[model samples]
Target: MEHRQLVHFLAVLDSGSLTAAAQRVGLTQQALSKSLSRLENELGGKLFERGTRGMTATRLGESISEYARDIIASAGKLRHTASAALGLERGRLVVGLSPISAASLLGKRLTQFAQNYPNVRIDVEGGIDRDFVAALHRGELDIALSSQVGGQYDGILLEQVFSEPWGVGGCVNNQALQDAQSISDLADGKWIIGRNTDLLDDIIAETFSNAGLPMPKPGIMTTSVLFSLHALSQSDFLAILPQSLCRDFNGILWRDLSDGAWISPIYMMRRRRAHMDELVSVLLRELKG
Candidate 1:
């Protein structure tokens, strides 16, 4: 029930052992045990089952984690709200992104945000959409940018950033492409696909299938955006990229699919709020601006 106990609970869950969690929380082994015991007594159940290797969350502990994180996040938000009322102008925001999407939100905008709100702390982590969405539900991330999303997330909302279709692209100076007038001409070329999920593979399959061609076996499956972009520009892989990038992204040139355009949208994601927080609003504005 106590905030510290919940914090300790999560520490143990994340760290996977009492000794490690105790060390992390700056508590002696005995003190951490007592804290855990007090929390178990309050909740009327054993939260974790201690084992020789480490501690494992009992069913109760596993289930209570989301509620614990929500309570902690709410409490932190309340503190921030009070601070804002006192004109403190201090805040923390966490953002999640896939590497390529950073181009949309980082650079000048990120630098400007840091300069204008030096008191605000920002944490940006790179990951795929599903991981980011789970983090959002756990109160880990403030916002995210993603290319593809599906299924239901309980408290998150998505906003499309663009509706433009991505184009197939190859090295601007690839010798093989000089005689090519359509995607079919490069059907045998090695392609780049996403690594974190099968979504990109499926998209490739569908795009080729729609064009009445067998899918090109992926040459490189990667999550590193820079590598993918570099490979595309440097004559190593054909890729579907942002429309702007397809035309010219450091030597990548757009090539027609010759069947139809392949649309890959970019979206911004955040938690749904009845009343938006001031700092979050500012952050969103900077990202979209």
Candidate 2:
């Protein structure tokens, strides 16, 4: 229950032995063992099983270890938050971003935000749209910039910031892509596709299905914008990318879908009840601007 006890337990779990944990924590082995014993007494359970190789956590220990880690992390965050609130000039912001949006927009805004809020530490995680949305709901992220995939969340608020047009991109000189106009025209061409649940992939799949074409054979599937671009640049495969992504790539040629517009509506989403701190607000404003 005590912070020191939790720390000792976590050290043992991580180091896999009381001797190593003691050395890491700068305590004698006896002291570390006493601390573990006290913690076990307080919790009424054995935390570890000793073996010739190392210590292993029991089921209850494994469950509590996760909680202990979270508790320690949350406590540190709270201390940092309190310091910032009291004008101590120290804070942290965790922002989640979709990979494509990170490459296209969030990366720049993040740099500017860091320059503006020099005292605030920023951590960024990039993934597909669904993972970003799920992180927002789990309170793991302060804010996120992602393409809208499904309906708005009841507990989260989203503000539309921008709409980016999507286009098919391929090697600039791909001979197989000559005179391609519609989605079906590229059906037989090798395709680099985004993963399922990715906003761009969902849109591309729907467009192809609506055109009564079989889904293009996926030569590569990726969540990384850079990887997707790299694959397109190296091979004769085509990929759907944001207009902004292909604008500066002379090695790539973009062709708009002929049937309908494929636009990804980008949103800045955060939990509805969560307080928007100054740093988060500044980042959001910079993104919107």
Candidate 3:
């Protein structure tokens, strides 16, 4: 019933022999054998059956193995949680970022977070809106910053931090769109679209569709803000960019679509009842500020 005895049992089961298990667990073969024997005695059952081939788990052993794994996993988690609580373990934070947020403010927030919590390791993964949300739901991300697509996450909480209007962006010196007044006016220009979720593309297409104009096929689809900006600045391609992002990019001129305004709400997602670690709370404050 001892933790070490359970570990020794699992090792022997995995290695197929006492000698191999002893070597792996850094114990003498006889010592490991005795430990297993003691464990079986304590549990009032035989754990393993020795045969010509190798050691095999008995029915009782098989039943116990499942519980043993859970016990060991829980013990490890307890140790980690305690260490983190005591500030003995340098924590790790995994953040998921949507493409637009990455372009506007994520980098600055990360820089400031790093300066504040130098001991905590921070990992940033960038993806489109859907992928980021999926990662958050699957527990692969500690937090996610992305646009709010109305949906319920049963055990997750979403906080709306800010809302920004969408705007049409193209080359600064594009003569073809100088007097563009509406979505219908941009019908002849090629559109540059961001891949994933298609939020921007859908809005653009809807604008043209509602205005009785042909929806322009996107000439380029990308997740990279830099690539999208480069394409917009050097060619006649227009992209729907968040107004905040347009403001961040000094040289970009944004024209509001007259069809109606598209407002994208930025949200912070985290597990609902989960404890917010100290570093995470600090980072959230910085983001909200």
Better of 2 and 3 by TM-score: 2
| Residue-level lDDT tens digits of model 2 in 38-79 | 999998999999999899998878989868866665655564
Superposed by TM-score, candidate 3 places the C-alpha of residue 96 at a distance from the truth, in angstroms, of: 1.1
Model 1 alpha-carbon drift over 4 Å, by segment: 1-56, 86-90, 105-111, 115-119, 163-165, 195-207, 230-235, 243-260, 273-275
lDDT tens digits, residues 1-289, model 1? Answer: 6888887887788778888778756799899999999999999999999788799999999999989978866865675575456442677767786655665434347668878988878777776677676556545567887775764477789887644455566787876665676667776778886542245456656766776798766788876656877887776577666554454457877655544445556677877752356776776777677
Model number with the top TM-score: 1
Give TM-scores for every candidate, taking all chains together and pairing residue i with residue i: 0.68, 0.64, 0.60
Sort all candidates by lDDT, best to worst: 2, 3, 1
Candidate 1: Cα lDDT at 165: 50
CA displacement after TM-score superposition, residue 254 of candidate 1 (Å): 4.9
Model 3 lDDT tens row, 1-289: 6888877887777667777778756799889999999999999999889988789999998988768756655554454365368561377777877766665565577778777777777788865444544444434467788773456566668887656578788878876567787778877888887752345556656777889997667788776778887778777788877766666664567888844547676778876644566657767888887
| Error at 51, model 2, angstroms | 21
Checking candidate 1 for backbone clashes, the offending pairs are none
